[model samples]
Target: MTTESIAGATVSTQANVYFDGKCVSHSLTLADGTKKSVGVVLPSTLTFNTGAAEVMECVAGGCEYKLAGSDAWQTSGPGDKFSIPANSSFDIRVDQAYHYICHFA
Candidate 1:
């Protein structure tokens, strides 16, 4: 399901801005210490490297993504999800605003 709200989370007020403001997010820590982030990528192509494994959950809008070592670009829209390995990277092509939740695994 699409995450509409994050309950019992301690949110960091300062935004994590990247790519000269093309992308931004706020870090969140749940009561049990699970880490997550809610962010948006504006219209641009950007590469993101992960420190931890992640499940990318789409909440609004969409993006085309090409995972590391892959040639195909896949589409992710509202309610869609994708996974990326730890210490890996992925390329995202955003045609419009792509809203997402990054769930650390």
Candidate 2:
């Protein structure tokens, strides 16, 4: 791999793309891809394998999650972190505007 400098800070960018509906995107291959979001709405469905994620909120909003086959959704709001288990996927729903971060490992 190669390294570069940006704005007097050493940072890395592997040419990841931010989805049209999402605010941030990252390509971390250590376990799984990592994605960080801010002021954007994401898809309701997500699947992760061999990894998990930590969700953080800057401007908190209502967030919901559910298993693929389940009809009920687990909900959260402001200052909450949702754990996405490996080998299992989840669906997320948001109510109101928010700024948040998602780190996958």
Candidate 3:
């Protein structure tokens, strides 16, 4: 797949703070002005709430996740992507470093 660059976008390095430092994301706006975050999660299990719909692509390592309302835990690896609904939450378990790009919709 081809990747498009987000031209003239600003990068924010601040942690979301909700994860209590377990996750840190760098935010950038795409050429079309869509905001996205690329982040790495240290080896830890954490829960996160989302304000918008998200498509999370595993860029390097991977993690297992249990989406809200679901009891099944799914595994995603490099190039794998998962969708989370808006105003929802999910649980993620990382045994090793997990890198991902989160596209907000």
Clashing pairs in 2: none
Model 2 misplacement above 4 A: 1-19, 26-39, 42-59
After aligning candidate 3 to the native by TM-score, how far in Å is the CA of 98 from where it should be? 1.0
Residue 60 deviation, candidate 2, in Å?
1.8
TM-score of 3: 0.86
Tens digit per residue, CA lDDT, model 2, 1-105: 111111232224643344444444333333233344334345434332324545444345556666656788876665666665555666666555434545443
Q: Mind giving the per-residue lDDT tens digits that candidate 3 earns over 1-93?
A: 323344577777565544666788788876777888888888899998889999988888889999999999999888889999999999999
What lDDT does candidate 3 reach at residue 86? 100
lDDT, residue 38, model 3: 80
Clashes (backbone N, CA, C under 3 Å), per candidate, total: 0, 0, 0
On a 0 to 100 scale, what is the lDDT of residue 48 in model 3?
86
Q: Candidate 1, overall lDDT?
A: 0.96
Our tally of clashes for model 3 stands at 0
What's the C-alpha lDDT at position 33 in model 3?
A: 77
Higher-ranked by lDDT: 2 or 3: 3
Q: Distance from true position, residue 43, model 3, in Å?
A: 0.8
lDDT of 1 by residue, 1-105 (tens): 677888999999999999999999999999999999999999999999999999999999999999999999999999999999999999999998999999999
User: Which regions of candidate 3 fall more than 4 Å away from where they truly are?
Assistant: 1-8, 13-18
lDDT per model, in order? 0.96, 0.47, 0.84
Predictions ranked by lDDT, top down? 1, 3, 2
lDDT of 3 at 7: 58
